[model samples]
Target: MAKRQPKLVLAPAQGIPFNLLVLSQSNVRRVKNGVTIDDLAVDIERRGLLQGLSVRPLLDAGGQDTGTFHVPAGGRRFRALEILVKRNRLAPDAVIPCVVKPADGDVSAEEDSYAENAFREPLHPLDEFRGMQQLVDQGGKIEDVAARFHVTPAVVRQRLKLACVSPVLHEIYAADGMTLEQLMAFTVSDDHARQEQVWELIQSHHNQSAHFIRARLNESTVPARDPRALFVGIDTYVAGGGCVVRDLFEEDRGGWLQDAALLDRLVLEKLGAEADRIRAEGWKWVEAAIDLPYGYHHGLRPIEATHTPPTEAKLAEVATLQAEAEALENEWSGADEIPDEIDARVNALDERIAELAGGSWNYDPAEMAMAGVFVTIERNGELSVDPGWVRAEDEPVVESEPHGEGEGAQREDGVDGDHRQPGLAPESGEDEVQTEEEDEGIKPLPDRLISELTAERTLALQDAIAGNPQVAFAAVLHNLVLATFYYGRAESCLMVTLTKVGFGFQPSGMKDSPAAVAIEARHAMWKERLPESDRDLWDALQMLDANEQAELFAHCAAYSVNALYEVAPKYDNGRISAHTVERRLVHSHVLARAVGLDMVASGWKPTADNFFGKVTKARIIAAVTEGKGGETAALIDHLKKPDMAREAERLMDGAGWLPEPLRTPELPAQADLLEAPATSELPAFLAEPDVSGDEEPMAIAAE
Candidate 1:
């Protein structure tokens, strides 16, 4: 093996004077790439030639060696040295390092040049980022590093940020396990724990999109474009000790606010100040909130106000705008599509006219004193002041009762049917005094006893109504009408009342509730079938036969039920008393049974995120005990709350269990009401079946 290796002759190396070296036409490199020769020349002049140029003996036609050398490889270096000589920086006779090769060497000058240019690998981006970061960490200024590398300061800073990614992610990036974009996403958060958590969550998933990673990292943050953030300018936010996180790798729309709680506090503080300022305008009350739920003015009356007339100058300006708009419209009338400038002008004129016309409204002083204003923020981050909203209870009370003759009969309690009163005046003499014992031996029942009796009566009435579904259905319809047309009053046979269900504060996942989904679907279905006009509804209902009516009645009756548990009234002004809520729920259970509601059967199941994850460990265990078995609950009791909740959720799956509110109260079985009950017993209107009689079975099943 040793004998087989041929003797290797290395390329010759020697020093050559700058004057003797000459550029070679055989050099392979022609196109510009990487660093330019001019930049190389500056570098060589500053530091002298770093790499030796490749030179060959300049041979004449007779093959005799010439004293001058022809440079091949590193021609750029030769040119750089030549420029220095031309600038008189380098002496013409200055010694230059050169690698000499025989003119007839085995390796051609072109091959040597090509090898030098194409063999070296460029540095990886991650390596460059890390190198930059190291320089920054070692005390090099970002500006200094950028100047040294011929890059923008922003680019240097971005590279430094990428270097600040979670070390675990950096390792992955270095190993080519993650993309550069994903690594950039991790730079959004400096917290290594959160970065690793988000990475761990999405790493195995196919959807490791950079945007998804950024979104997950910034889930709890407020986008810079959010109305709240816009209202509180970024400068003010930062001045108030808030931070913003930016994505240097992609467009982030000015980035995201890192401190959501601080932003909220600032928003509330500003809104409160604005509210106070508005309150100083002599309004009775000013309700301020970031957002008011849709239909917030329910059960309140909005008084119409007279608009203030515009000033003469403003009127003239409006007239001018109108004239301009008219001219533009006339000029572009025949065009299929209006020009953007003309359209913009028309829109601007319309807005100006509206602003001029929508002057401040004037309300009567008396009405303003009793009315309140809603100080709110609009979607566009502008302040909105809605005035002249009067609650029903706030309206002045009018005397409606007739006066009686005697002093005692005059209702000295200050109002008729009023129970709360001051202690009866102490009589002056024994003859006039009527003590408790001196009065008849009768006393009113205790309030608690009255409540209990009414509770029982409510239960009995619900049971009775359940037996007669026809009356129950009609009562529900009557209640709905009373609620719609006569707010705060009822003339229905049923005492139940359904408050307007406001979209007030929503729980996190309420929109995903199966009950909400079913309700929405049903609403859409009925909306499509209902007549367009209110006047057409009576005829439409008449067209539906008995079976359809019964089905429709059952559906409509569902809305009137008030089974929700509410806070008891601390003050007696509210309609529902503490005991009333309790009794109402108890009666609701009976109604629920009559309707045969089974929430579990209605496509609801316990899940860790939606239900179990939110509750306490004890609640989760209790749910597992109820839905699964006590054994299952015991198995998970030793686990942490989150883990126990998840396990309990899994164990409770497919088990027909429900919370008290959603469960249909179990009732004793009876013969099928549809088959046994006589048709005559049903409502006169519902006695006859539909033409197809298809929905009759549905009505029975619904009951």
Candidate 2:
């Protein structure tokens, strides 16, 4: 400072004619990078070159000034201006903004260029989003902003979607508390409260993966791919005032409908209208249901219907379609693979041909008088109208009530109340036209879905009875009392009965469960003490004390606990429609509750292979989120399903997690544990940008 800083002389700011400014070799940006020359030119043309080029005077050996200038830094800018001059948009002699430097070696053109290129830091995504949001808030059209920024409107839309997420989430995202992918998932739902709720729910969970976040956000809503939503078209759903939350960042498959009940209502209304229209075609009764039970036609009669024959015009159309199909098949038969367009065309044609070939069915009025129609949605969201079903009560009554005393009842001729549907022969058995799966409709609960439930349930029920002799005494007393006092109505309960449901059908790992081990040990102990022969069983049992007899009785009675859930028969499909099954579930749960059947205490804990692996990734995340906090659940959300399941199993161990079937009606004390943590209304960045637009900004930054 004492030396008086050398009188500083800086580069002169001046304008050079476009023709005089030539790009210099010292520009270090050799590799092609962000912002194409064309785009830069457009931006310059639109905004008129915001930055000046760094240039040096071209001089002779004497270091004298020449007319032309050489640009070093801002090579892109120079090229953009040059482009305008070439396109005749700007005159060749147009003055371009630039900083003129001396010909001296005080500063190298390469140094200037390197400084410009090397010092540039890409704008943060959040900053970009904020700027874009600012432009939008200023009433700038999305397209206009995109054009100005040299980005697509879709890109603008995706950035803008970030605004829809809760401010708490935005702050978390800014702090790197959540990943960009997870934030993207939150954009599907615009509800600030819901977004925050989901965040809190996941923050404590081990699995906060993007997929899990999306699933959690869409829990209460129906996905666009759902059968109900698909049955009711998106456009139609929107027209009905239903809100669809679309994810701009991910493949949302369309989006989720926020109003699931509304979609269901629409589907029901549409189905009802179709049912009414079908009923007008002449039928005894018509019903519209969202899901018709599996084997709904059981014990019911069916009538045959004839479809309208094809006319000459229809036949010609069919011939045309068939010819097209054959031509396509021949053309692509030798190819390694057909293009998607060609394949789609072939499939479309096949479907059309099948539709045309099936024609329309005309039912007989006589059969229609007794038969009913049921309209339901098919799995693929297509309309499925099942007609020609006659209920037992609706069947025609044969006057077989003994024409004389000597004449036997209807059963004498191998014909009872079972009346054959009109227009059909006796050989056509019930559900004969249905596939095995269709007939079974939900037969044997989906293997993996209930595998854990079934396995754990059997163990819990058996172990509970074995441990609780008091409940066993009462259960036995209840059964014996009903048999003695209630005569034929001996069917008192689904649980604690004499009937032994085989364990062969139970899922794997059941034999390895604690209850199974304990039962095996107890049975082995009894076997060692008792006589092996059936003849000596009574004497061997009689030799035991009262307590031993009670323990053995409880063990034997425990085998009757069939807590497994199988779809009850809609009608009597052989087994006496235990329609009592639901009541049995209730009664058994009551008995289990009486025995203080705490599944957790009974040693039933969810594991990867038993529970998590058997369920969807979403379920695993949900269970983790439930047992552990959402933050804990969020920890594993990003993992692949198998990995997530394994991790979830680890986190959930000793967490006392129970699947729906294993749980009783009463919820634990932690039901309200999913509430969101207290958070500021908006992030500082978003709020600070607008002082007068809304509320205080420092409320959060202060913390």
Candidate 3:
């Protein structure tokens, strides 16, 4: 410990003439890498050599200094200076600052070169970003900084913007707690507090991806493409004191809209203005909402308004479009996949022709007096004005003076007051005074009320006939015979119409449903086979085989099936007698039974997303009990609701079970053919959640 240590000696600093400097062959840098000599030369020309070269004097056979120097470490730098001199940018005798090593030292030129290459560390990307930011902050122009770094201005700016991220995140990135990409995602939102909060939430999650981080930050914000945001233009929203969050790191699809509540208010206000304009048109009521609930049209009557006839110019335009569409279709007659350009052109032509052929319709004063309009935004961000909707209470009522009896009424025996034959009246043998039974007939339903009932009946019939091909053919033949033989005197339950109902409120997932795909394919095939002209449709149908005709009729009738449970109720004021919705559902069940429909076989299953996540623990247990017996269900009964649902989904796979709504009522004959299962007791299922809502929920297991 007491021994003295020798003092460290350093290389002497001196200036050597550029002409006397030469690259050392003993340098350890065998592989050429990093910046090119020309680029370094340009850098040197702009600003003289920043770092001095390491040089050792060459020795003769006697081991004496030869006055000429050789670069052992900074060979690249020496070569760059040589390029500058060759280009005449520097004088041949220019002095180059160098750290001159002793000629007689034990350190070889290769050792010096190895130390120069091995002992240096490359600058981290974050450090570079920060250094560039610091330079810009110190009054340096971005262009000057980019030039110094030999990078594009755009690249420089992107890196410098990284400094805008939270300091904590920067430290995290430096410490390798998060990746550079994730750190970049954090910069999309400038809120340090939000970034920290998101990190705290996702730090323990297995999915700590950059995408997840961005999504968490935008939880309450609306994307630029969101229909509500699109309906309210971003510029208008900004003018109304809304802020837009932009992403500098990537293409952000026009960025997200902050202040979602403010955006919604603006949307509602615009919808209200549109509603006011419609109100001026004398609508009974005009309702404005950002979004209307599903089945908003329930208990209301849809009426078709008189459309303005197409003008000669519009007709000519439609004809031209039709011609173009026909030519395109003929050219691509049997191609499996038409080219996108041709397909798009054909679609555009078809749309334009349809638009030109049809006239825009609006409600007249009389219809508006009895109907209302719903002004809202369509999914495409367009203002949608749904007019000519007559609510039940708004339908007109017929009045009659006090009379002996109603002119039109139905009796308990199903005889109509106006339809009773004179021969059925009381004869001379019977008392002339009217009895209770004689006056039991009630007033018949109004014409509009009868039409609503008939509409529901027609829908039920369509579903019934579609599922039964024999019935479908028979129904069509019956209608034809009635029209041909009995003229207008006959009435049938089945009524086919050219009108097709649109399910605007269909679930988003239904777009890709198996049923939907099949229906769409069949519709396309028929559309392709049919003639362009309506007059030619009859001839085309006659030309089809019997099976083809039956299939086409079923396809058409299938479009009329409306099994959706709508919200409709009757009022006590006689405004509406009944909704007839339950009757429609009963018919749907019957049709389902006839077709032997199996929702499970149709690729629908009770999963955590569509079923379990929305239900209670007890419901999940009950489902498991039904599908996999009480014994198996008991295994997951002790777990928490979430765990229980997951377990139940696993246990119930391929069990052919269905939720209540999706279940088709069992057929009588099918039920008779099944054997009853024996019941056995298992562990008790969990009780339902308490109604008080104060009890600790999800505590079945200790976290």
Candidate 4:
């Protein structure tokens, strides 16, 4: 195997003489006279130099030893050392051990030197661009130059492009510290002038933040150049690069352009559907109008006809005949009864009178005149006439005319008086008028009842009950009792109102009996069916006082109790078993303690006849006994003196004064001597053999 080459070493700073290191490359040509050794010195002092020179031994043609080495890199560092030395600074003598690679094949030293100068400190873009230009000028392919610095050719082009960009844009780009990527995105145009314009745009906005730059770019009004113009054969603008077109479309369609094409299409489809709906609705209205009854197409129109006046002979004959009929009707109206002579004349003239009248003489003018005269008629059916009648001094006499019996000879003129009689029958229009009048007279009862119930009387009652809670409670009780007993339809409405009032205010009465009753009534009404137990409970409720009833039926309600308890009391009047009452009292006591009400005095007093008395006596007995056999002895010990005992004895004596059956004796002594004896087994009682059996066998045969 080949041995590994020795690794290159670097010089250390400590314990080394400072005057021996070579400072510069004698062979390398200088490009600028302004470049000085002091520049290198300043750089070194500011940032302590981290890298050393790479150099090789220099030889003359004679192959003799020469003291100089050709610098492969670090020319700047060597110059910096020279400056320090001239300024009386001690220089290190350490040989910065280097790999003597062939200089012709290696470009890393140049690239690294440039990179250190460009990046180790911030270099202005102009300076970097100049550096890149020099590198490309020095027989370096742009790619190779770019690759050596670990940058893309595009990036390198941007730096060079920066040289051509407007100074304004360059300053702007530099001020904002924009990335090359951002600048490339902005520089689509190859024209230096256009690129300069864009640069000016970019620079003018340097004072703007990144967000503002993006907004301006988004807002730029310049129309997008044809994609083919921008890039050969390109058919479309590059993604996300189009200028917003604010005025490209009509205002109504402007919003459509803002959305994605697909969304816009969907919106347009919806708009089309809506338009179709509107058109359909419009057409429906048109169709309906066309089909409507009493519409223009179906409406009535006025009729036009020529008029002719009646002949003068006919008018004179009608006037003469009307006057004759009026004279005859006046004569008939004045008569108490139509006289036989006048009746015959009136009947004969009736046909002629009807013909003279336009259509009918069946319409008696006398009847119409009588209707007017009867305006003063009293509702009691008494006819009245105007007293200021003008009486004729001499009445015109009506001539009697004989009737011609032959119908054909009445007139050759086609005249029928009977047709006129039909019009005189009282008009059917009066029937319709009377019907409308009747409907106007009647109203619905429920509406009236509701109105009456809500009147001031009801309101005042409600207010009074509300102000005096006791009245509200009594009202609730009253309503519940009514509901339970009647089971009427209105019971529910009444109970509901009472319950609302009951709950609205606290009961000021002894108990919430009314509230309980209302609750029970509601429950009974709402339940599937009334249970017998509920009926019994109702009966039990009535015997109880308000407090007892309230307490007993509070869960179910006293309405049921009141209904039943009014008839029966013993079982339903909240008279629970002593044990149950005791349990309830104990529970109440426990609850009171738990809720911090234990210290409150119960204010309970007991008498022998009452439930409380029994409970109290039982409690006292239990306490005194306490599983001890000295309860009486305890009581005796508790009464300290003989006189006090005598007083107690007297009270006991008085209690004993009642009938023997009614009196209760003192409790038995603790140590009374009435021990029960142990039961003994008597030899099974043997019955003596009956002599009647003559001699029963006394022993069994041996078996």
- Candidate 2: C-alpha RMSD to true structure equals 21.7
Task: List residue ranges in candidate 2 displaced over 4 A.
Answer: 1-11, 136-148, 175-177, 306-361, 400-703
Pairs in steric clash, model 3: none
Identify the leading candidate in terms of TM-score: 3
TM-score of each: 0.59, 0.55, 0.61, 0.17
- Writing each residue's lDDT as its tens digit, candidate 3 over 458-531 gives 78877877799865665564444333222222355455333344565554455456886787788668767875
lDDT of 1 by residue, 595-689 (tens): 68777777777777667888888888888888878877787777667656656676787887776556654443575644564532322212334
Clashes of each: 0, 28, 0, 10
Off by over 4 Å in 4: 1-123, 130-150, 160-164, 172-207, 221-233, 236-703
The per-residue C-alpha lDDT of model 4 at residue 318 equals 69
Task: Give per-model CA RMSD.
Answer: 13.8, 21.7, 11.6, 44.3
Worst 10 residues of 1 by lDDT: 694-703
Compared with the true structure, what per-residue lDDT tens digits does model 2 show for residues 52-135? Answer: 888888876787877888888898888888788889889999888888887676778899889988888987777778889999
Candidate 4 per-residue lDDT, tens place, 1-703, comes to 9999999654332221224334334434356444466765765665555665655445568865365555545666667766776775534463344445343434544554465445556677667876887777788887977766657887777666545545545665677766644554333333456545434454433232433332233332222232112221112222323223322111312111112343323333433444345334222111111011111111111111223455566667767877776798887786688868777776666666555444322223332221111012122212222211111222234696633432212234433211112234535575575466457766323323356678867788777778997546544554454344323224322445212112222212212234334554565453423333333434444555788435433433422221111111224345433334333344543444454541112221122322212333344334234322343425433332422232223223222122111122232355542453443211111123336756554332221
Using TM-score as the measure, what is the rank order of every candidate, best first?
3, 1, 2, 4
